[model samples]
Target chain A: MPAYVVGHKIPDSDSICSAIALSYLKNAIGEECVPARLGELSPETLFILDKFGFEQPELKLSYAGESLYIVDHSDRVQGPDDIDDATILGIIDHHKLGDITTSTPLECWIRPVGCTNTIIKMMYDFHGVEIPANIAGAMMCAILSDTVIFKSPTCTTADIKCVEALAEIAGIEDPQALGMEMFKVKSAVEGTPIRDLVLRDFKDFDMSGNKVGIGQLEVIDLAIFDEMKDDLHADLAALKEEGGRHSVMLLLTDIMKEGSEILVVSDDDDLTAKAYGKATTEGRVWIDGIMSRKKQVVPPLQDSFAG
Target chain B: MPAYVVGHKIPDSDSICSAIALSYLKNAIGEECVPARLGELSPETLFILDKFGFEQPELKLSYAGESLYIVDHSDRVQGPDDIDDATILGIIDHHKLGDITTSTPLECWIRPVGCTNTIIKMMYDFHGVEIPANIAGAMMCAILSDTVIFKSPTCTTADIKCVEALAEIAGIEDPQALGMEMFKVKSAVEGTPIRDLVLRDFKDFDMSGNKVGIGQLEVIDLAIFDEMKDDLHADLAALKEEGGRHSVMLLLTDIMKEGSEILVVSDDDDLTAKAYGKATTEGRVWIDGIMSRKKQVVPPLQDSFAG
Candidate 1:
C-alpha cells in the first residue's frame, strides 16, 4: 500500500514543503509516498512556491475518512475522535503533544526545529539525496518563513545547519537576497482588498475564555498605516462582530517606525483599556512599542484574562 | 549613529526572527541596534510569535525613506535607486547577491544557508548568550518554518545543526510535534471570509509572460473541501479580477485523499486547460498525483505559458 504524507492545518510553507520534500525523499527510498496538504496555502506561501517552481500540494480538507502518514499535526490520544486511524504509521512534527497514543506502534520523528521542511531536508542529507534548485528554494523559503529568517526564539541549531547545506545546493550566496526578492514581489499591495489586507495573516485563538482573532498587516510606508487606520478600526469592529469574540486585536506595526500601533476592539472597555494601558471611550485602545504581542502583550493579557 | 537591522518584505519567519535575534545579539555586544521588520507578519507568523513569548518586530513596509542595515535583502549595484543605500552598515542574508555596493562598506555575513536566523542563532551560541525558553521556542519555530521542517531542498547542514542545538535548549524532544501544533492552531479555518482565506498565504509571480497568483489550502477533511469548492472557485475568479493576474490558481488538497482538485480561473481557457491536462468545463481543472507543484505542475505550466 502506498503511504500518504499529511501536514497539519493552515498549511504554511513548512507544512507544504515538508510534505513535498518528504515525498521526494520517500520516493528516493523506494517508498511510494504521496505529499498531502491539509489546508489552504496562504499568499505568502504561494510566493515561495512560485519562486522555487514547486507545485502546491494537493489539498485535503477532510481527514475524517482516510489513512494518512501524519506530518506536522496530531490530536490528543484521549481527545475527541479527531483522527480515526487505527494505526498511525509515522508521525513527524515539532510542537508540544498533549495526550497522544498510537495503538499500533509508530515510527515517529518529532524534532523541536522551526519547520518540518528542515527535517525532510535532513533525512535527504542523511541519506545522501540530491535536491533540485527549485526544491532548495522552496525549502529555503519555508525555513525563512517559519524561522522569521531565524529571528523567532523557536529556532534551533539543527535548523541552521540544514539551511547552510541547502543554501549551497541552491547556489544562493545570500539567502537574505533571495528572501528579500520574494518579499518585494509581495510588496505590490495595490489592488488588494482592505479586508484581505487586514486579514492577510490573521489567526484565531481561544484566549481567556474569549475567542480572539488577531490580524497583522505589513506595509512599506508608515503613512499608509495612518491612511488605513480608520478603515482598520472599522474592520476590527466588524471582525469583532463577525468573530463573536470578547475582543479582536489588530496590530498595525510600522516596521520602519520600530513600534506598533495596536488597535483593540471589544465590548469590555476595561479589558481593552487595561490591555492597552489606557481606556478608550470608543472601546478602542492603541498602544506603542508593542510589536511582540506574544511576548509583550499576550502574557499580560493572559494574566488579565485570568484576573 | 544607531545601526538599523533591515529585513526583507513579506518577511517570513526567518526574516523577522533573524532581525530580532540579530538585534538581541547586537544589543548584547553593546551596539546600538534595533530590530526592524521589513514587511508584514503572516497569520502563521503571528501564531508562532504567540506560541513563543516574543513580540512582532516593528513593521517596516518600505525601504524608500528609511536607513537600512540590509538584512536578508540587497540590491545590485545598478538595479535601481531603491536598491542603493548610503547607510548600509551590514548585511546578513542567505541568498546570492548580484553586484551589491555598500556606501560605508560595512560588515557582511552572507551565507548560503537555509535561513539568516540560523546565522544569528550561531552568533548567540558562540557568544554564550543564554536564550530564554520562549526565545528558544521562537527560534526553533522560525527554523522549522523556514526549512519546511527540514524537508525543503534548500536545507543545509548548518540549518539542521542550528535546529538541533536550539531544540535542546527549547526543551523540545520533537520539533515536528511543535510544528504540527503550531500548524493546527493556525488551521482552525472557521468563519474565515473566502477572500481572506485565499489571500492569507497567496503569492504573486510573473510566470512565463503572464502574472499569476497561486494559493494553497490544506485541510484535514476532504468534506470541507467539497463544501468550500464553489466558494473557492468564486474566490479564485475574484482573485484574478482583483489582483489583475492573467491566472489565479487555488489548490484544494485533501491529504487523506492523497490527491488534489485544482481550480484554475483565467480569461484564456486554453491556458488553464493545457496546464491541468484538461479542463473540467467549469472553469476548473483536476490533476491527480499533483503534490509538488514545483516538481510537477509549474514546469508544464511554464512551458505552456511559453508556448
Candidate 2:
C-alpha cells in the first residue's frame, strides 16, 4: 500500500499545501504518496486551494490504522487505537512536537521553520522539481500564513530561501502588496453574524489548569467595537459555557492603534488578575498592550499555572 | 529636529507596525524618531493596533513640504508638493518603487521581503532593542497580515529571522496556530454589504495594456459565494461603467481549496479571453487554478496585453 501523508486535525494551509507539494515531490522521486486531510477544511483554506487550482485532499476522519506521514500537527492528540496499526513513515512540521508513539519511524524531519510550505518548497527546489505558478502561489500563501509572514519565531533560513526563489518564479515584486490586498479582502466584516464573528478565529488554550478560549475579530469601524461590546461580553460568557472552561477571553484588537482592550468574563478574578496583571470585580478585565495570546498570554499563564 | 517616519497612504499593518517598531529601534539607537501615519488606517489595521495596546500614530493628511522618513510606501505617491521641502532621509519598503524625485539624499532600503514589519524587526534585533510583548505581537500580526502568514512569495531570510526571534521572545510555540485563529476570525462574512465586500481588499493592475481591477473576499461560509453572485455581477457592471479603460475581476476564493472561481467582468471579450485562456460571452471566466493576482492573474494579463 502507498504511504499516506496525513496532516494534523483541522488541516491548515501549512498542513494541506505541504502535503500536496511534498507528495508531488515524493512521487517525482518514485515514491507512492497521497495527500490526506485529517479533517474538513475551513473556507479560508478552500479559498487558497481554489486560487491555486489544487483540489482539497481526500479527507480522513482519523489517521489511525493507516500508514501515516504527518505534517504541521503531531499525533499526541490521537488515541493509541488510531495509529496502533499504522506504520510511521516520516514527519515534517514547523510546530513543536509532542510525544510520538510510532515504533519504527522511517524518517522524521521537524524543523522550527516558519512554515511547512517552506520545507516542502525547499525539498522540491533541492530536487529540481519545477513548481507551477499556482502551486508556488499556494506555497507562498502557506508560508505567509504559517510564519505570520516571517514574523513568527518558527521561521528558518530555509524558509526564506524557499520564498525568495518562489517569489522570483511567481513574479511578485512585493509580497506585502499582495498580502495587503488579500487581508483587505479578507476583512469584509459587514455581513457576518455576531456569533460567527465571535467564533470566527477562536482558539482554546490550557491556561493555569483552566481551558481558556481566545478569540479575535477585526472591524473597520472602531465604533463597531463600542456597539458590539455588550453583545461580545455576552458571547464570551456563552463561549465559556459552550467550551466548559473556567473562563473565556476575547481581545477586541484594533490594528491601527497597535493596542488591545482585553475582554474577560470569568469567575476566578485571581486567574484573570494573574494573567492580565489586573482584576475587576465585574468579572471583566480590560488589558492594554496584550496581543499574541500564544507568546504574551500563554507564557504568563503557564508561569502562573506552574506557580 | 526630530526625524518623522511617515508611512504610505492607506496605511496597512506593515506601514503602521514598521513605523512604530522602527521608531522604537531608532530611539534605542539614540535617534529622535516619531511614528507617523500618512492616512486613515483600514479596519483590519485598527484591530491589530488596538489589540497590542498602542495608540494609532498621529495621522498626517498631507506631508506637504515636511521632511520625513518614508516607510512601506513610496515617496512618489506623496506628490512633489508634499515632499517639496522634505529631506528624504531613508526608505524601508517591500514594494517596487515608482518614479519619485528625491530632493534630499535618500538612504532607501527596498528589499523584496514580505513585510516592512520584517524589516523593522530586523532593525530592532540589529540594534539589540528589547521588544515588548505588545510590539512583538503587533509586528507578528503585521507580518501575518502582510505575508498572509508567509504564504506570499515576497518573504525573505531577514523576515524569517525577525519572526523567529520575536516569536521566542513573545513565547509563542506555534505562530501558525495563532495565524489560523486570526485568519478564521478574519474570514467571517455574514452581514457585510456586497459593495463593501467587493471593494474591501480590491487592487488594480495593468494587464496586457488593459487595466484590470481585482478584489478578494474571505467568507466563512461557501454558500455566501453563491448567494452574492448576482449582486457581485451587478456591482461589477456598475463598477465598469464608473471606471477608466479597464476590466474588473473578482475572486470569490475558498482559501482552503487553494483555488478560485475567477469572475471576469469586461467589455473587451478578447482581452478577457486572452487573459483567462478562454472566451465566455457571459463575461465571467471561471479559472480553476488562479490565486495571487500578482502571480497567477496579473502576469498572464500583462503578457496578453503586451502581445
Candidate 3:
C-alpha cells in the first residue's frame, strides 16, 4: 500500500501545502505517497490552493495501521486521534520537539524555521528534484502566511531564502501584494461563526496533563475583532467546557501592527496573565510583538502550566 | 561559550567519532562547536581514534545552563544528568524517535541507518564542507564497527555507500580488514574487571517508568565468553542493585555467528523470556540473528513493558 503524507488537524496553509509538496517530492524519488489532510482547510488555505491552481487534498481522518509521513506538527495531540496505532515512516516539521516516540527508526526533517514548506523546499533541493510551478506558488504563499510576510520572529534566514527561491520558481513578481490579498480573505470574519473564527487555526496542547487550546486569527487590523470580543469569549468558554480543557485562548493578531490582543477563558484565573507577565483587563490583554504561536505563545504557556 | 557536541554515556566508536566529525563540520560552517564526551572511551573507540591520529575529547559531566548539540543518541536517560537544565541546540541521531522534547525549535538529522557517522557525512555534504583524512578514517571505522562490517541487520545501503566514499577519502583499500582489526581490540575481556566489562557499551532506557540497563559485547567467537557468563550475570545483578534499575541485561554477541546470548538479571522473573518469546535457561537465552539492541531488542522490551 502507498504511504499517506498528512498534516495536523484544523489545517492551515503551511500544513496543507507542505503535505502536498512533500508527497510530490517523495513520488519523484520513486516512493508512492498520497497527500492527505486530517480536517477541513481554512479560507486562507483554500485561497492559496485556488490561487495556485491546485485541488484540495483528500480528507483522511482515521490512520490506524497505515504508513504515514507527518508534516507541519509533531505533537500527538495535534495529530490524528489514532496516530499511535499508525506507523510513522517519517516526519517533516518546523516546530518544537514533541512527545512522540517510535519503536523503530524513522526519517525526520525537523528544523527551527517559520514553515514546514521551507524544509520541504530544502528536501527538494537535496534530492535534486525540480518542484512544479503550481506547488512552488502554494509553498511560497504558505511561507508568507506562516511568517506574516517575513515579520514573525520565527522567520529565519533559511525561511526567507527558501521563500525567495520559491517565489522565483513561481514567477511571483510581488509576494507582499499576494500576501496582502490572502490576509484580506483571512480577515473576513463578519459572516463567519464565532466558533469557526476561533477554531480556524486552533490547536490543543497537553501541558503537564492540562489540556490548553489556543487559536490564532491574523488580519491586517485588529479592529475587525472589536465588536466580537464578547461573543468570541463566550464561544471560547463553551469550547473549553465541551472539550474538558483547562483553558482556551484566542489571539486576534494584527499583522500590520505586529501585536496580538489575547482573549483567555481559563479554569485558573490569570493563567495567560501569569504566563506572559502581563495583567489582564476583563479577560483580555494586548501584547506587542507576539506573532508566532509555536515560537512565543506555546512555549511560555507550557512552561507556566508545568511550573 | 562554544556549544558542546557530545554523545551518550559509555562512549562507543560511532558516538565518539560522530561527535568529533559533526563538531568539525559545525565549525567549518562558522559556528563555534567543541567535541566532548560524557564518559571514558572504550578500547575499540580508543583503537579507532589512535589509528586515525586523533585525540580523545574532553570529558564533560554537567550540562546545566550550557548550549549542547547532542550526537548518536536522543534518549534523556542516555544524556547528561543535567540535560534538562541545558539549552539543547540540536540533535543528530540514528535511533528511534525518542522522548526528548524541546521548548524551542532545533535542527535534527535522524535517519534509519546503521551509524551516526553516516548522517554526519551527509551533513558535511549538505554544508559543502570537506572532511579531513583523519576524521574520515575515524568515521569509516565507526560505521564499520556499528554495522559489524555491513553484517548487522541495521546496516543500510546509505551506510555501505558512505563507508565506500569515506574509505576512498581515508586511503583505505580494505575496510573489512580494518573492521576485523577493530573487533579484535573490542574483544579483549580477560584483563578487564567484571564491572568494567559489563559497562563498556552499556545504556539505560526508561520504558514506561521502568529503568532498564542493557549492555552488549561483540566478539568474533562466542567461546571467548563461555567461561565468563556466570561472572557477567553476577556483575549485572550488582549493577542493577547499585543503580536501582528494574533490570540489567547484557548481550554477548558473536559477530561471526550472527547471534547473541542474552544474560538477564531482572526484578521480575522471565521478563526477557516473555519479551523475546524465548525460554530462558539459567537466566540466559541465545537468539540467532540478533545483533542490534536498538533495532531488535529494545523495541520488543519497550512494547512488553508498555503492554
- The superposed Cα distance between candidate 3 and the true structure at residue B286, in angstroms, equals 1.5
Model 1 C-alpha lDDT per residue in residues B98-161, reported as the tens digit of each score: 2344322134454556677776775576567877666677778877765556654456798888
For A116-139, candidate 2 gives per-residue lDDT tens digits of 787677567556788878778878
The deviation in Å at residue A104 for candidate 3 is 0.4
Q: Against the true structure, what is each candidate's TM-score?
A: 0.44, 0.45, 0.97
lDDT of 3 by residue, B50-159 (tens): 99888999999998989999999989989999888788988899999888888888999999999999999999998999999999999999999999999999999999
Model 1 lDDT per residue over A54-136, tens place: 77777655545444566654433212244643335565665423224332224445455766777677567656788887788
DockQ of each: 0.01, 0.01, 0.84
TM-score of model 1 vs. true structure: 0.44
Q: For this target, which candidate reaches the highest lDDT against the unseen true structure? A: 3
Give the candidate number with the greatest TM-score. 3
Q: State the lDDT of candidate 2 residue by residue for B1-307, as single tens digits.
A: 6777877655667778888887887778888889888666656677777777889998766666566667875535332336644666666766533334331123444445677777677566545688888789888888876666666544556666777777787778787667666666657655877777677666655443455677766433446577778888889877877767478887766555555676667766676577667665565565554445544565567556655
**Each candidate's interface RMSD:** 21.6, 22.7, 0.9
Model 3 DockQ vs. reference: 0.84
